[model samples]
Target: MTALTLIRHATILLELAGQTFLVDPMLDDARSHDAVEGTSNPTRWPLVGLPTGAAEVVASATAVLITHTHVDHLDDTAIAFLRDRSVPVFCQPFDVAELTERGLPDVRPVDEVTHWRGVAIRRTGGQHGTGAQADLMGPVSGWLLTHGGQQVYVAGDTVWCDEVAAVLDVNQPQVVVVNAGEARMVTGDPITMGADDVFATCRYPGRRQVIAVHLEALNHCGLTRAELACDAAAAGLEVTIPRDGERVSLFQG
Candidate 1:
């Protein structure tokens, strides 16, 4: 059985096959940072407040997995919290130096596959955007975990691209976690998964269940949960969009 807790935005607590994985910990109050150059620059971002048991959730994390160095994904508060604990931090090779420089001494850069507690943690390439836009978005990564006869794919802040298709084709994760907020800048198209991207991922071959996160917390995100649900229904996908502090499991009865 797997327990997935959607803390807020991109932060997720995944407990699968007795191993607990914390993916992208953005631990702090809403509006903690300034808005990006483009996008809805509200006086404060994260329109909503922090989840109920945020501190406890962070404390319960067995291991931390970071996909990128974006502030929204790895905030100062999370870094402080993680530093106090003795858990191992897994991230892409590029982010190893930055995180280690940030005082996280136990950071481990995962190039290909790493083993932890009998689970296989693998790294995959991602296209944060297309063409020149991708360059601007910087380096990002997706993660795949195989355990307990199940494969889970955590698609980081990326759009629908060949890299994503390759991950799906090669890994064929049964449970797919997508950052679906349709987040866009004031200038270009959405940088995150939009309705079309969500539909495409849900319809991908061999994907049994899809979980969508990274919505409603930030001002830049234009897609709402209701809107994504409508689009998923239209695409015939029964996706799970958990709210803040909500938990959804992948175990079948």
Candidate 2:
């Protein structure tokens, strides 16, 4: 069976088919804008204040799944670190040229169903926002990973929309990891999945387990883990808000 571990915001570590898969790693010491503003605090003390031993993890990774090129998801430090590694990097089509420009040798764009180390990956289109926010964020996407006879969906930074619902309808993932920070600006609605959106996403017809993250770690995001958990329970949703460095696993029946 595949194990899904939430490493951090928009980051995850999955072990399946005797291979490790790291997704959207943001492991820099001062990588977040929240740190500069003194607003968000990391849930656990970072090991050496960075994604230390990242090379070791990357060394074991069968492939790296990159959803987008945002600084939090893909930064200079991470890019530099992975450049020397031989593992293939899977990313959205728009990000392929950029990765190539940055000197990554085996960068592949995720456009359809593909497999790495016996894990099935299907890339689905995503919507970032309604108007200008979507333009600024570019083309965000999500992934459906089928491994060991089960499915898991990782929703990249997004608000509640039809595309997300469509992903749910098609994949019917048993476990879901949502970027649930209720982030907002002074002028517009929240950018990331707010508590309400998280509820809606989790309440989708066939989802069995849901894990919410991307909270209390960035300036733009303001929701707390406790708050999200409480909200989910109140909404009668089965959700887990994991502490940083914590790990969870799912098994197929």
lDDT of each: 0.85, 0.74
Q: In model 2, which regions exceed 4 Å deviation?
A: 31-53
Worst 10 residues of 1 by lDDT: 37-46
Query: Against the true structure, candidate 2 has what lDDT?
Result: 0.74
lDDT (C-alpha) at residue 31 in model 2: 37
lDDT of 1 by residue, 135-211 (tens): 89899998999986788889999988888888888878778889998888777777899889988887777646788
| Estimated TM-score for each candidate | 0.96, 0.88
What are the per-residue Cα lDDT tens digits for candidate 2 across 1-253?
Answer: 5777666677778776777778887776643343322224433322223433556555656778888887778766678888888888888988998999998889988788788777888887776755786776688887788877677788888888898888888778787778887866545566689888888887778746777877766666778888888877787777778776667877654
Off by over 4 Å in 1: none
